[model samples]
Target: MKMKKILWFSILSLLLVIATGCEKEKRAKTKEEQIFPHNLEFAVFELTTHQACKVACGENGEILISLQDVKDDVDTNCSLAQFDSIQMMEQIKIYAYLNINGDSTRLEVPSKPCGTVSYYCKDKSEEVQDVFRLIDEIRDAPAAQGDSAWFFDTFERLFGKGASIDHTPYRIYLAKADPTKFDAPHARLEDYRLIFILTTK
Candidate 1:
């Protein structure tokens, strides 16, 4: 009877070990499947206007705009103003403003010949943090530095840049550029993205 009991105990232990090993292997495979390189997809939506982009990409080789959403419900009696905007590529080249840490790039803006799209970074790792930092920077930076005058002018020509129209609120997005989709190892994603904003007069 004692010998029989010992044999049963050994078999149970072996069965338990085999079951545990199989579980671990399954988990490992799941992790491997989700390990998609740095590439990710994002979307941007404007709450007030109901305008949204399915996908936004980065210009040059630097950064891409992925997810942008605005949920502000504040009431404002503002009118839309027209703008005359130049092509983003014509006005500037795409460039990334990286944070102190190499792990993340905060924002991607066009490198204009005469203007600077200044940005601030709250946290160098997270995407939402970077967006808030960018807003803070825009609020603090000098108007001349980020003057989208040409863009406004072009918009005005197309839509009417006067002060009587209702001004539309806008939002921006950022995403990780996919090397596989672009197929350029060194491509500074300057074209496959949603660029800057064009507001009215």
Candidate 2:
């Protein structure tokens, strides 16, 4: 009788361990499903300086950009213009996150600047001229009500009307931290640390 009772206890302990492990595995799978519902193709994020000026201007801030659901053809070698393609633009979604002094905010579908691809031109003269044109255009535009408004509206003027592009198959996004979203005073773009999260199809 004693031997039988000991055997039964051992079996029960083993069964409990197996059940717990199975439950844990089930929960992990569920969490993964929740995070990603669709097939992911590619994802990349980068931290770079937001070049506010053409020269060695010290007025630059750290910014993050993410490319998601991008086509296989596009890679680090591809210029921003290549990413500006309409087809890829429609398929991809970009996001930027900002953290300042512990406060964080998400810039959903952040605004992009016009003539983004011009920076990648091999011809230095042409690149400089195109960049100047973009700067002038932004300066001439009507004053925006806020930082967010200005950022979005400036890009909207160029992209909203279906601006033509020679490149195809990708879209690029530029993100900036909104001052109103955080409590920081006199906060410049350099004051915030940006993070980007990308998911590919």
Candidate 3:
């Protein structure tokens, strides 16, 4: 009877140690994610005009996607919101990151034009010009898990076929009502100099 009790105790202790180790690993990973979010090295940009967009992940200084509003077919009718429920594109662009899965938080005001920004460009197909208006200053932002497919999916749905969906995904988390704007969300065209900093404050 004493032997049986000792054996049971030993097994229980081993299980507790294993469980503790697993829990510790999870905490460490979560901390890492929170600390460093944006992957600047693999960052990509899409030049949007006439309500169209694209993604170019690997080609540095190359504008991968160029969306054009051909046929003038886009307006109130046959819009993105009309396709199933893809309301994320607008929110993502405005918010800097799409929250595919997160709690419903407060909605902030849409950013207005604050000031002008300049970009020194070289080694690209198109001329270098700052497309986005400066709303906030560029600073180091939190690491974000951006969805490359978020734009890719919408562009393909809007343009169809030849739409660009080829790029690496770096997740981003953005809010509607947040005060800080004009950073990543405000980035326009091919400005490799501008770096996105997701604000958590």
lDDT of each: 0.33, 0.36, 0.30
Q: Cα deviation in Å at residue 99, candidate 1?
A: 20
Q: Quote the RMSD, in angstroms, for model 2.
A: 19.9
In model 2, which runs have C-alpha deviations exceeding 4 angstroms?
A: 37-201
Tell me the deviation in Å of residue 126 in model 2.
Answer: 23
On the 0 to 100 scale, the lDDT of residue 142 in model 2 is 54
Can you write out model 1's per-residue Cα lDDT over 1-201, one digit (the tens) per residue?
A: 999999999999999999999999999766644542112222222111122333233432222223232111112111232225554223322233322113243333222321222222354234334433444444345552334443333323322211211222222322222121213334333322222332212
List model 3 lDDT by residue over 21-119, tens digit each: 999999987775554423233222332232222333345532222222111111221222444445523333221211112223321222111211222
Local error of candidate 1 at residue 10 (angstroms): 1.0
lDDT of 2 by residue, 1-201 (tens): 999999999999999999999999999877755543232221223343342211111135232322221111112222444655665654332233322222244223442322113234465335434544553456445563223346345545443322111122222233222222223434544443332222211
Model 1, 136: alpha-carbon shift in Å? Answer: 37
CA lDDT, candidate 1, residue 123: 44
Give the lDDT ranking, best first: 2, 1, 3
Clashes of each: 38, 6, 14
